[model samples]
Target: MHSWPTTTLPELPDTPARREPVRMFDPSRQAVVALTEPGQQRASMYVCGITPYDATHLGHAATYVGFDVLNRTWRDMGLEVRYASNVTDVDDPLLERANATGVDWRELAAQQTALYARDMTALEVIAPDFYVAATESIPAVVEAVEYLLVHNLAYRVPVSETVPAPLTPGAADIYADIQAIASFGEISHLDAAAMTKLFATRGGDPDRPGKRDALDPLLWRAARAGEPHWPGSGLGDGRPGWHIECAVIARGTLGDAFDLQGGGRDLVFPHHEMSTAHTSALEGRARDLAPAGARHHTHMGLVAYRGEKMSKSLGNLVLVSRLLESGYEPAAIRVALFNHRLHQDWEWFDTDMQAAAQRVAWWRTALSGYGGADPLVFLDEARLALRDNLDTPRALAAMDAWATRTLELARDGDDGVAGAAGLVSRGLTALLGIML
Candidate 1:
């Protein structure tokens, strides 16, 4: 598993006010729900991670930062958060990018994955309890595919491709029978036409002549020359498929009925939906596509730039490392992101960084002097705002109000206000994961 230092949580003051339970918007339910069940102290979540083909982009950072805030909020509310995530270290995109750049795929994945870890560390994201590579869980993946094939949830289909050294004639690839799942559309909620269109563009083979539905996801791909292959337990000499990777990893780490399944909004359709389906097939009963029976499907909004969503394929990436190298403070960049709601679709502007820097400067100035307003008020406001759907802008506005009050009243310099400013600053760090 990938590792990083633990972000220490701020301790409660002499009298930490009773905190409200965290409530996040669940897209599947179309309603805001408590993060954990009643009387439940421990919460489990699995978020999909990057494919590790390139540097960590701002879009990528935004997702992690948003969830980082969520992680902080949960701990503040006194819930034990067991978070797990995966790096798709052996996917098609990594191989394609490696081939295009003439670098070994393994080396490319390693270099980029290390860079991603550095960016996350610089941003101070609390690393997951289980941050594993897909390659690390192949034995578990094989067992999952074995379960699916045994229960008749997956089938084989033929492909016509040339290889330098061929062994089996009419080599067949295994596909999950989505038709067998009772809750295929519960998560995506799309009609056949929309699903088919999206499947074709989003790492799917809609045009492939298959024996089942066009939406049936690949379970095992037969070995192809010049591509990485793994033992597939008699299915063929190919690695596990995209959705199955997440299914096996998530189920293996978090177990069944985890509290939340989270990722960027783009993964709602094929990735999470099909992974959830695979989980259902493995467990041998449908939880309405709540695979491993996740209670909530929490998806962060997409980040867009220059009139299009920021994506690797588009090549309009604003990398986090590049911004740091350009002399932006990590705290300032985090404040810029905090200016927007986590679930709102917003575009990035150059001026955003400037504004965030100015905010951080003002905050530091406030912290250096004595203030009048009760520091607990700032703590209460930030926690309340963030606990509800991660309304970061509201939380930021509360901090600004506290800072403005502090600066405005510094001339009266209450020596009795010992550590008042420090309390508020630490509250900001603890509640919002912002370093003031």
Candidate 2:
């Protein structure tokens, strides 16, 4: 039996009135709104993790950074947060990468996952409370699928060579009752035509012979020759599909219902939408049980390079490892990413990094001699900005102003300036996850 994390996290200051309200963009609501109820003391988050092949690119960094900010803000507000994320160590991309390199898929997953951990640590992302991997949670995944099958929410379909060439090889089981979830297309906001196109493009086998609906996603993929496989109770030797891994892991780590579910904008469709459906189906049958529903569903904007979206396929990825190799500080990389709204798509440029580096240098110099003071005092502007839908650019602007004022005061020989500057330094660490 997989159990929720038992390790305790340190509690922070609990000044409810002093903490600023936190608002975030909700794709489900299609508007910015308060993310938590007033005076709520605990929060939980689940963000989709990477597949660990060509891992830790700028796009990945930005997505993780966006959620990291939310987690930090929640904890800084004195809310205990249970954050769970998955490492998709046994996905198609990992298999394909391993096959191409003639490396054992498991070895490749382990190696790349270690590299991903290093990148995230260097970027100063707070470690998730529960960092579950699909391979390790295979038993949980299989059990969840069996539940869905017994409830009639999912069915096993036969696969044959005559299936469309684009369909995933050996995919056999699918979630059948997609219509059960109300507002299904509202989250992604995709029309029939666009959703259909993206579904086919993003691993959806819309035209699979026995599927009831075009949008139905594979729940279990029967094992094929040369593919990684696991034995299900009665589902045969195959790996779980992309969407089910997260659903199972989230339930095991953070209970069925959690406060937040987040991922990159690209996942709003088949990935997030389908995952929500599967979880909802599970809740329907297990009526006496807790429902795995996210109060807010959020997505970070895609990071692009040279007028194209950063992706492994486009070969336009601005990898974090490469950037570190080129001598760019992780702090600067994070600041550059914070330059845009978390929900707005933007292109990455060399100039952005240069500007962020300069900002970091200025802040470091400004706060150099600063000692200790209440970090919350210098955080008004930053706090208010962040409270407003995680307005990072505005928070950064506030930080710039804080830096300027502190430097001016210090130049004028103000006695309290050093302490104030120190507060600003600590506030940056708390609010922005940046160490000055």
lDDT of 2 by residue, 49-125 (tens): 88877767888998998998888888778788888999888887788889899999888888778888888888888
The collision pairs in model 2 are: 256-292
Candidate 1: clashing residue pairs, number: 0
Residue pairs in clash, model 1: none
RMSD of each: 1.9, 3.9
Q: Which prediction has the highest lDDT against the true structure? A: 1
Least accurate stretch of 10 residues (summed lDDT) in model 2? Answer: 1-10
TM-scores for all candidates: the values are: 0.96, 0.90
Q: Where is model 1 more than 4 Å wrong at Cα?
A: 14-18, 163-168, 287-292, 370-372, 412-416
lDDT by residue (1-436, candidate 1, tens digit) is 6657767888756334335667888767778887775577888889899899999998888888998888887787678899999999998899999999999999999999899999998898989999989889888887888788888888888766655333456778889998899878777788899988989888998876865888988888787878888877677677778999998888889996788888898888888889888878788875353444677888788888888999999998889999999999899989998898867778888789999998899889888764446788888888778778889999999999988777767756644356788788788788777776
